[model samples]
Target: MNKVPMTVAGEAALRAELEQLKKVDRPRISKAIAEAREHGDLKENAEYHAARDQQSFAEGRVMDIESKLAEAQVIDVTKIPPTGRVIFGTTVDLINVETEEAVRYRIVGEDEAEVKSNRISVTSPIARALIGKEEGDTVIVRAPGGDVEFEIDQVQHI
Candidate 1:
């Protein structure tokens, strides 16, 4: 499988979720299943069926997380020297060339991209245009609304 790029924080979050699922959710679901089984007929017991479904979903998630962890290429931006160049895991401050509006974005993995939080996936149009560019450089991004120009104000490795 191809390696998936992930920031240190992203990797940590996934690990934490995996830990919670394995140590807490897994055991809790097993107990629920056992209790449901004791309630009576397996054929008609809604609780038993629900517990089973939950268990299946949880187990599937656990496997998915494990596979992602195995293929994750964790990148700690803080460990790299800041060169004002946009890169994965780096937070970038940009100024809209036309509107003069300032916005900040953190380049992260596909799974970690949350536009609401200003974290953009590396493959995003904006990020793609920003990557390899240094601070003070102007980049043009082709958005669905048309082309937008931005000036790179700052790059942070935090």
Candidate 2:
């Protein structure tokens, strides 16, 4: 199995979610299933069918999380010596070359990518363009809107 790259924080978050699924979600679904089964008439019980469906979804999610954790390569940014260059889990500050607007993004794994949190997946176009780039380097990225240029202003490990 190919290893999936993940930051320490990302791995922790996934583990936490897996724990919640196994401890809380799994038990809740199982209880619901038992309660529905107790209602009798399994052939025509809508509640039983619904509980079963929920159980399927919860179990699937738990399996997926476990698989990812098993194959993950956790990288702790704090332990990595800073190189002043962008890499996986590095937060980069950039200025739009054309508009001169400042923006920041932390390169992370695909599973942890969240625009709302300013996290971009390492495989994403923007992160690909930023990787290995040092401060003051200019890179052109193919964004969903169009091609955009950004000048690296800063790179931080945290």
Candidate 3:
């Protein structure tokens, strides 16, 4: 499999989630299953089945996180030399050329992309158009709403 691009913060978040699932959720579910088994007649026991389902989901997530961590290429953008270009993990400020609306976005890996926080995936339309671009560069993004024009105002490697 190809190496998965992940930021240092993203890797830390995944590790934290894996720890919680293994250390807390795993034991809690095990205890619940045991208590449910004591009640007998598991064939009709809703609690037992519920606990089992939760266990399956949790275990699957743990495996997924482990696999991602194993294949992750954690990038520390701060350690990179500043070149004033829009690269992975760079926070970019842009303005809509037509509407003059200002917006900010950080280019991140697929796993860490959160639109609500303005973190866009590297493969996203705007990010793709902005990649390798520098301040004052114009970008045309083919968005779902239609083609939109933007101007790069600044790039910060935070």
Per-residue lDDT tens digits of candidate 2, residues 1-158? 89989999999999999999999988998999899999999999999999899989988999999999999999988899999999999999999999999999999999999999999999999999999999999999998999999999999999
lDDT of 1 at 150: 100
Q: What is the C-alpha RMSD of each candidate to the true structure, in Å?
A: 0.9, 0.9, 0.7
What is the number of backbone collisions in each predicted candidate, taken in the order shown? 0, 0, 0
The candidate scoring highest on TM-score is 3
Candidate closest to the true structure, highest lDDT: 3
Comparing 2 and 3 by lDDT, which wins?
Answer: 3
- All candidates in order of lDDT, best leading: 3, 1, 2
Residue 14, candidate 1: C-alpha displacement in angstroms: 0.5
Superposition error at 74 for model 2 (Å): 0.5
User: What stretches of model 2 exceed 4 Å from their correct place?
Assistant: none
Where is the poorest 10-residue window by lDDT in model 1? 75-84
Regions more than 4 Å wrong, model 3: none
Candidate 1: the clashing residue pairs are none
